[model samples]
Target: MKIGYARVSTGLQNLNLQEDSLKKFGCDKIFTDHISGAKSHRPGLESAIEFVRSGDTIVVWRLDRLGRNMEDLIRIVNQLNERGIAFYSLQENISMDKASSTGQLMFHLFAAFAEFERNLILERSAAGREAARARGRFGGRPEKLSNDDLRLIKTLADSGTPIKSIAERWEVSRTTIYRYLGKLN
Candidate 1:
């Protein structure tokens, strides 16, 4: 039996194209979710996984329709293989089953490419951050209080001034004063 899974990013998007493809592919049943691929808790996908058994093949309109990313795609396909099931992507014309060495090789190559791409991205990001630091441009939110404000806060704290009073003067919360004074820690 071929079980089909389809997804759309939002309710505004229709599942017709995916459904039609799955139907044409002779899917015994089709499950769908009107949720983004980034979301983890897709009930329709969960149902499709639960409905399959040994000898069943899971089909999708495209690779992207089945997973949030490359990692997720590999994870799901590996799980299906472990369960004695197969996976097929209609648009990609790629199929994976326990019996196919070519399919397994292709899948492994895909995983390797995904990992290599991630490593390159990490390297580029680190270089970009280093270059930005060299230019005296730091990331993250700017400091809310200036050096003068910090000095005044420290002095007020040393003089045993009430936290609420100092906070009122600075127009910030007492928690902010406590945090700056290292009292919160």
Candidate 2:
């Protein structure tokens, strides 16, 4: 059996392209998720892994769909291999099965390349951050609330102002208010 898995980073992205490719590849069943690959918990991926048997194969439209990074990809592939299942990536032309030595070598080579690619990205990012720092700039999103806003929130809360009212005045959730206060603790 060839069980397929399809994923998109967000709900706004369509899964049709992946699903169609899987169907065209004659997948017996295809599980899907509309969530970021960085997330560890994916119901569809979990289901597909659990559904496969010793002789079954797992297929994905692309290698990245299986994992967010090389470590994750290698881990999931290793788990499948340990379970006596084959893995295939349609776009990457990677096939790893129990009886194929060439396939095993290729999988390792691909994993090495993936790792190198990740390292390159990290290096580039670090260089870019350093350049920004040299110019007195920083990355990341700016804070939503300023110190003054926080002080006002603290004052209101200390004066017995309702959390809901404070949240409304600050245009934030009560949870956010608690979180900011929690930071001081």
Q: How does candidate 2 score on lDDT?
A: 0.90
Local distance difference test values of all predictions, in order: 0.90, 0.90
1-185 per-residue lDDT for model 1 (tens digits): 99999999988999999999999999999999999999988999999999999999999999999888887888888888889889999999999886889878877887897798789889999999999999999999897778789888999888999889999999999888888778423
Backbone clash pairs for candidate 1 read: none
Cα deviation of 175, candidate 1, in Å:
7.4
- Candidate 2 per-residue lDDT, tens place, 3-105, comes to 9999999878999999999999999999999989989999999999999999899999999999888878888888898899999999988898746997688
Top of the candidates by TM-score: 1
TM-score of candidate 1 to 2 decimals: 0.76
**Weakest ten-residue segment in model 2 by summed lDDT:** 98-107
